[model samples]
Target: MELKVSSRSHGDHTIVTIVGEIDLYTAPRLQSEFTRILDESTTTLMVIDMSGVEFCDSTGMNVLLSAHKRLRERGGVLEMAGPRPAVRKILQVTGLDSVFTIHEAVPEELLAAEPQA
Candidate 1:
């Protein structure tokens, strides 16, 4: 399936939502999106919404890892949210689940407004 990627800002975070399969053919698109977000945005936290991802191969995984590494090098953070069962299993098997802060969903606290003093 074709890959779709979109990004938006939420508070101090930038959320990138990705849908469809991610294989060797489609990984480049995702990588490009990540590169664009990292280069264009100054947000310290980047959360990848993987709920719509149906499949991911090693190339795709590498792209994610590279993005995580880049963010870390810049003193930023890379997180993942709502990965499907199959993709979750890949992360677990590859030990990436531990490398990234995995969220069941984009954390509500990030989306919530700060209480006025």
Candidate 2:
């Protein structure tokens, strides 16, 4: 299924909420969204709200890794929030769970303060 992505800015971060299956066919869309957010905004953090994600594959993992790498290069970070069971398992099985910061939800404290541009 095609993925749906919507984003909002929180402090120095951008929270992108994604829904649908994340596979080879749909990963590029997510990648583009990340590229756009990173290029167009003064965001230092990217939070992926994966609560609605029904599935995730290697392609999806690659997309996340790429974003993480890009952000880290700029001294930024990528966080994954509220992933479903299947998606979480994929991350765990691939030993990628340790690679990202996982949250139960968007950290309200992070949203309360916007970093200087």
Candidate 3:
């Protein structure tokens, strides 16, 4: 489908809304986007908005995992936002629901999350 990365600031954190299916074809692009952001050293927290992702295959899950792993090692964190029921089911079945921080698409006070040092 289509992907849109919306950047916003909540205190010192950066939120990016990802709207699309992150399959094999699109995963690479998303991966690259993360790498670029990481290199910039401007984003301390990355919130991937999965609210618009209608379908996600294993490849897509892997993409998210890869990003999480990378961020963890780098002392950063990547969070998931607004996953639909289908996608949520897949993540829960795979036991990734516990690993990732999931949030509803609501108005929350985005505090300045700490960066990995």
Candidate 4:
């Protein structure tokens, strides 16, 4: 499936909404999207909206980790929102649920209002 990425920033936070299947074939596209968002301006918090994700694989998980790593390198952070149950389970089983900050697809204003960890 095709994944469409949309991005916007509020203050120092940039949020990217991901809609569609995320697999090896589309992970590169996600990476490119992130690059573009990062290029738009300086930021320290990145939020990924996963409410529309239909399917995912280990490759998709790797993409998530890469995003986290990318933000960390800049003393920043990446948080995922509303991951589907299947993907959520995958992340949990891989012990990554604890790695990526998660929330219900809320706005950045209220997102940080409640920290997952």
Alpha-carbon RMSD of each model? 3.3, 3.1, 4.8, 4.9
Poorest 10 consecutive residues by lDDT, candidate 1: 108-117
**lDDT of predicted model 3:** 0.76
Question: Comparing 1 and 3 by TM-score, which wins?
Answer: 1
lDDT of all predictions, in order shown? 0.91, 0.90, 0.76, 0.84
Superposed model 2: Cα runs more than 4 Å off: 111-117
Q: Compared with the true structure, what per-residue lDDT tens digits does model 4 show for residues 82-107? A: 99998888888899989988897756
Give the alpha carbon lDDT tens digit for every residue of 18-94 in model 1. Answer: 99999999999999999998898887899899999999999999999999999899889999999999999999999
Top candidate by TM-score: 1
Q: In candidate 4, where is summed lDDT lowest over 10 consecutive residues? A: 106-115
Report model 3's TM-score to 2 decimal places.
0.81
lDDT, candidate 2, 1-117, per-residue tens: 779999988668888999999898999999999999889888888899999999999999999999999999999999999999899999899999999999988787765664556
Q: How close to the true structure is residue 111 of candidate 4, measured as C-alpha lDDT?
A: 53
Clashing pairs in 2: none
For candidate 3, the 10 contiguous residues with the lowest summed lDDT are 106-115
Candidate 3 per-residue C-alpha lDDT over 1-117 given as tens digits, one digit per residue, 9 for 90 to 100:
776555665554667667777777787777777777666665556787788888888888987888788878877788888999999999999999999899886326563343434
